[model samples]
Target: MKKHWSVFLTTFMSLLLASPVAFAASPAPQVNAGDTAWVLISAALVFIMTPGLGFFYGGMVRSKNVLATIMHSFFIVGMISVEWIILGYSMAFGDDSAGLIPGVIGSLSKIGLAGTAGQIVSGTSIPELAFVIFQCMFAVITPALITGAFAERVRFKAYALFTLLWSIFIYNPMAHMVWGGGKLFALGALDFAGGLVIHILSGVSGLTLCLLIGKRRGYGKLPILPHHLPMTVLGAALLWFGWFGFNAGSALGANELAANAFVTTQAAAAMATVSWVVCEWLHNGKPTILGAASGCVAGLVAITPAAGFVAPIPAVIIGLVGGAICYFAVAVLKAKCGYDDSLDAFGVHGIGGTWGAIATGLWASTAVNPAGVNGLFYGNGGLLVAQIISIIVAYLLGGIGSFVLFKIVNAITTFRADEEEETSGIDIVEHGERAYSQSIMTGESLGLPNEFNKMN
Candidate 1:
């Protein structure tokens, strides 16, 4: 009996030793340093997009709330960064214990990313830290995008609480469903860069929040002209540059897939920008640079879901459709619907995301992405049906979840600044600072009458 046991143990050890050699004999993955470096840079580039968002949102609002709007984007970088490190990553990516929520809150208990360096997840050569950092950038920008809808009115305290709650309840769960080992990923939903999970969800949440908060006082009556159109333009340029990373980096490797995503992103943005401008020129009698930029962003948002799955032509079509649809949504639906999306977050991101998701179902093809499914145009109508379901589910869930969370937050602290404080402007009243202090000081220093103060 002892001899038989020894023989079995010896055979098991021999098999284990031989298996690795057999596997090594198969084709090995070519680890390209240039590709790795490019992806790393791309990840950092995406992280830069949050600040670009801050500037874009900052310049679009009246100067009164410029800093306040920027702060919301800035705060997202800090708030969600910590959340991602603590519970967020675990909830999304950890072992699927119950096949629902990720098994343990402390599954990633090694806080401060202890021992994360040099660690490798199976099937990939990249360090686990690289994946963590890449995903962290996604978490940072998503809530920042929502700030556009509630730009001028929401109190800082309420804003902070809402973002915290959102990171926990909305962003984390949707991320798990769409990207992590959850039912949605299991069901074969294709989201290359978070069109449904981030853009649509945040867009719906933004719309709901703005509705609940009501319009800014004297919204229609007030001119509320953007204080710095040039700044907004520059910000848009930055967004365009940053988006290459946002879409391409999702491929996680600098391979043909990444190159395809890059081209698709550019084509979509260009087509959408042109389509939006043409539509606006026809309807509004002229196309403003603001409209052009907005159209580009709408296209970017729309193409995000289909970036990896669709070819360049379909990407362009998707962008054009997104631009046309989002333009109308911002121009027509907003006023008639009586929702005051302060910076058009709902009109652009929400509507664009919905269109993009549907477009993915329409344009997806196995030629560009073998792992992805073919869409309706490729004779797969079921994919389109699934996309529609995804859209409805995302909007309803995100809208309701955000509303409830805001209510809870509002109950704890006043959600809006008092009328007196709001009238005074958040920079002075809330932050005890002004955005153009130097300009104000210079104006005061000059004996001549201050045109800026008079304009204000």
Candidate 2:
């Protein structure tokens, strides 16, 4: 009896000693309240940007196509939201351990968010659901940004199909490559927010699509002016407000990195605004509100990739140069190239994103975020090379992927509206509605006047 008791006691002690190590090997994640709240709030902020973008683009288009233009952004919010829930999130962030082409895309292990419940993100204290929702907002807005390129000319059905396909093929793979431990991440390229993934991809794709879709009827023959500057200004304000979330939220925590990003975002935007207005004043002899709004956006785009890696001063220089370059692209390059990018999507986003990416390589510093490496000015040229390579890859993916998707969409249905439809108005032809009941200029009822008005 004593021998048996001794053996039992010894075995129990050994098991107890081994339990802690076993648990330590796969410890459960702990949630942080502060981090979770910040991420959720940031997600909400990004969600509003799509509608804000609608108003911005809608105000720039002719009055006859305003509703149709706005519809593009609004509808995408619904369409892409559903797509993300179903498969987008999985393809964008799922583990690639089982992928046949590892580092290019993700596996479908998390499809429909199957195993996400009660799970925490790998490096953060937030729940996996929080990350999914935040990224969903990004996926929703990217394709919507493309609408500005072919506004007032694309068939609604064709636009819908192209956006869905583009999200699946272009946006998903790119997101994985940059943020999901894929090829770009493995290659040590840094994109703090989305210079290569969002701005460059959408901008270049917009350029390709606009070229393929042809110009709006009378694009060069007639003057195409914005119908509502106030609305556009309001839209710009919303975008500016939301951008703090876009840049800072990328930090994934409410910490010093987030604070730094916030400061840099403001500094870059302000400097860009000043530089753009000054440049316009010098070149055109006057500064326009449109120029100010466009400049601010350019600066925002240019600073996105470097927000976390750079200091506030570097951000300002980036913005100053970015605003001027984008202005030139819109004002001079568009005119010289003779391509009708209806709203300068390529000019501001593509050009700004390219500059921002290269600037990241030029100005990035480990001092700002120890996770990141130094850039050219900080005594490292390899980062600059990486940035250039990423830029080239982005251009190729955006241009080639968009071309193929456009062709497929066009084959399924006529991509561009007919000449008669263009003249009559896409709002009425595509949506059977008008933005306004009466024309402010003529005081006349718009959109095929009612029988009583006709009789009058």
Candidate 3:
């Protein structure tokens, strides 16, 4: 493990420090105004999911850490945006390399976006800039998704560092393999959006961290109720709204495929929401807002890989199963297993994403988008097998890579909040601010903006 870590660090450092002069810059391609406009809109929409994710996770944690919990997602947006600009974009989407490792991990020839502005991505009308910005939104959300696993117990500094390193180590490689035309691309693996890349990588990382960090100070004994379900519901709505852009934008064109992805996204989410509510009602004898919200997100995650390959009918099946399976994972599996995933990141995203990728194998149809292949149901078992291979590769790489990085980050930074801070609350102690206050109306001890404030 140590040797492997050293090797990975050495390789990553080389890419990090590589000069941008290695590869000859290609002339800029003519970008379609309509495609550029659509991609821009999609990128903006996907970016909003981070805040929505913040609200969703925030509402699930104790009120004392509301601001801190929300801040994880909020802060990562700015932090990973910078990291992406630094070397992430280049490492994931740079020109193809002859080196075996570089093919799997991308070359740094395009590092720092040097010589990439007006260039058009090969075979697409969208500007390379639009593609870069769109992919940046993905990098931003992947680490934020992991925050759910260790919420209320993580040091903000450590989490931020993990985001930076994880983007380089785990997230970037997966992005390259699946979408950046790396090894998996050569193997004919399909991830129309990010079933294997974003959701699975984040999910595996979340589960690993939950196990490594152990349960929160209080395990199953404490009742960590959600502070606000409405906020979570609203967040769910925003994720649904943003996901259309996430799925359709993968088409990278303003064409029929994008239209199909748009409708399928809506169909899957709607059905999944309904199915989740129904499943919860059957299991617990009452349907909760949280269940419905989770189901909606689960459906979105599951359909993501197949959005362009499957029609509305198949999408409905995918969403329904996604909701039911995720419900089981969250409601039954997590409790039975006794791991405290504070916000069910692994349950919904990890499980849903894995299933979605497999389902794409079963339901993918070349008819929906000619660029894609037919699935098992559509007379091709090969695509399904390819999807499974991609899933396995993603699981091993994402899970193991994340575990090593977490240990390293912990060794250096201690990674988690101290017991006292975790108990007292991160919002007040870590951020020096409260989510709620009474300064204008009642000034006293714990008054105004500071927890240290005292009336004289």
Which candidate wins on lDDT?
2
For candidate 2, the per-residue lDDT at 286 reads 99
Stretches of candidate 1 above 4 Å error?
A: 1-32, 98-115, 437-456
TM-score of each: 0.89, 0.93, 0.89
Clash statistics: count for each candidate: 0, 0, 0
319 Cα displacement, candidate 3 (Å): 0.4
In terms of TM-score, which candidate is stronger, 1 or 2? 2
TM-score of 3: 0.89
Poorest 10 consecutive residues of model 1 by lDDT?
Answer: 99-108
Q: After superposition, how far is residue 157 of candidate 2 from its true place, in Å?
A: 0.4
- Give the Cα error of residue 325 in candidate 3, in Å: 0.2
- Residue-level lDDT tens digits of model 2 in 1-456: 999999999999999999999988966779999999998998988888889889889889887788998899999999999999888888888887765357877888877889999999988999999999999989998998888899888889999999999999999999998998889888888999899999999999999999999988777766678878888888888888888888999998899999999999999998888888888899999999988988898899999999999999999999999999999999989999999999899999999999999999999999999999999999999999999999999999999999999989899999999987887778889999878754552124445434222211
Q: Write candidate 3's Cα lDDT for 372-411 as tens digits.
A: 8999998999998999999999889878988899888898
lDDT of 2 at 419: 83
True-structure RMSD, every candidate: 4.7, 3.8, 13.6
* Better lDDT candidate (1, 2): 2
Q: TM-score of predicted model 2?
A: 0.93
Residue 447 Cα positional deviation in candidate 3, in Å, after optimal superposition? 20
> What is the overall TM-score of model 1 with all chains considered together?
0.89
lDDT at residue 221 of model 2 (Cα atoms): 66
